[model samples]
Target: MAKLYTQESPKQKNLQPKKESIDFILNYSKALSVINCKDKKFELLLN
Candidate 1:
């Protein structure tokens, strides 16, 4: 099993999310990328 993050270096330990929380962050990042792409296309159409 993977060890928890507290023992990791100070820089790395800044992110201490649980597995589920990390998964949620990943999903949100992907969704944001898609949304940004769509917004770019809309801007191009407006221009």
Candidate 2:
């Protein structure tokens, strides 16, 4: 009689982002709001 063997693979891991990355996203959103307001003001002046 012969015995059969099976091979197994290791599981993958998920990495978490750092705090600085989250802060950068928040600051970027604030900058975009300022740019949008400036664009709107410029358009009003042109009219």
Candidate 3:
């Protein structure tokens, strides 16, 4: 496969977020896990 990522906008590049906000970081990770679990359940239903 050819290298897939093409380019990022300058704004997108500069918008790197801090990893040190303890509460915000934890909530963000929990949200991702919930979304992933929902997606997996959805795929199981489709089968």
TM-score winner:
2
Worst 10 residues of 1 by lDDT: 38-47
Writing each residue's lDDT as its tens digit, candidate 3 over 1-47 gives 78869676557546656777776767765555322564473222210
**Cα lDDT tens digits for candidate 1, 1-47:** 99786765557647666999989777766555322564473222211
Q: For model 3, give the 10-residue run with minimal summed lDDT.
A: 38-47
Q: Rank the candidates by lDDT, best first.
A: 2, 1, 3
| TM-score, ranked from best to worst | 2, 1, 3
Off by over 4 Å in 2: 1-14, 34-47
Number of clashes in model 2?
Answer: 0
1-47 in candidate 2: lDDT tens per residue?
68757666656677668889998887776555322564473222211
Clashing pairs in 2: none
True lDDT of residue 18, candidate 2: 89
